[model samples]
Target: MDYVDTFITVAEDCAAQTGVVPKPRGGRDTVAVLQHRMISAAPYRLTQGDVLFSTWLLQQGVDPATVPPEDPRRAEFFAVDRACLRASPLPKTHGWGLHFDAEGRVALVAVDDPRYADLHDSAGKVVKAMRSSRAR
Candidate 1:
């Protein structure tokens, strides 16, 4: 079933712009991974991603017993903006596009996959994607 309050499909011919885009890695990739896990499993609002990602990072590669709540890095991960996913490498580096459902949950669609055409055009919106470079 297709729902239609917000017509926005993220897939497009980004080939020309792809070269200009930078691959997201390090911390950015970390944020993206967290977001992807949530979205792929179930649609989630951005706030959920922020809290979960912050919490999840602490458990990785460490013993929960010794980890301190006051670690400086905790604040950094906690500060990661959910908008970071919009500019994620999932589209530019990985050739996959993302779109939100009627419920405002994100899902990735392959940019080159013709089967995803149904998701390309948002009836009322012009559509937009993230730029790889910062505005400098």
Candidate 2:
């Protein structure tokens, strides 16, 4: 399956597990927003391996926030981390990069790229959701 399919599949599973529904929107904009949210809401306790995979998923338009806690996609997601994929290594790829910080929260660096910036606003919505959830 292509990235879009992978993203939708993962999103569906995440929604089922987390009870967080992803609003469907047409075009690249929706994908971008979802991807940003995934990166931002991913659990800080993720293993280094998970962190690497989460980064790759972010590029592929998977939102961590929407990921089902028990989704199999998370296995593949974490696998990428084990492989240690790097954005600088594949600069030509449309959406391939890993951005994380010492705090484990999704750093803004990933969104800084022109390709990712467009989704920042939508991702902000997801971040708010995450904050609310954490506050509870």
Say which candidate scores most in TM-score.
Answer: 1
- In model 2, state the lDDT of residue 28: 41
Query: Worst lDDT window (10 residues) for model 2?
Result: 1-10
Candidate 1: tens digits of C-alpha lDDT, residues 29-82: 454454455455554343333334443664375433364668776567657754
**How much is the lDDT of residue 68 in candidate 1?**
68
Q: In model 2, what is the error at residue 9, expressed in angstroms?
A: 37
Runs of candidate 2 with Cα error greater than 4 angstroms are 1-44, 77-81, 85-136
Candidate 2's residue-wise lDDT over 28-112, tens digit each? 4343344345444653344334445555566676765577667788765555534322211121122323333344333223222
lDDT of 2: 0.35
Clash count in backbone of candidate 1: 1
Which residue runs does candidate 1 get wrong by more than 4 Å? 1-29, 43-84, 123-126, 134-136
For each predicted model, how many residue pairs clash, with residues at least 3 apart or on different chains? 1, 5
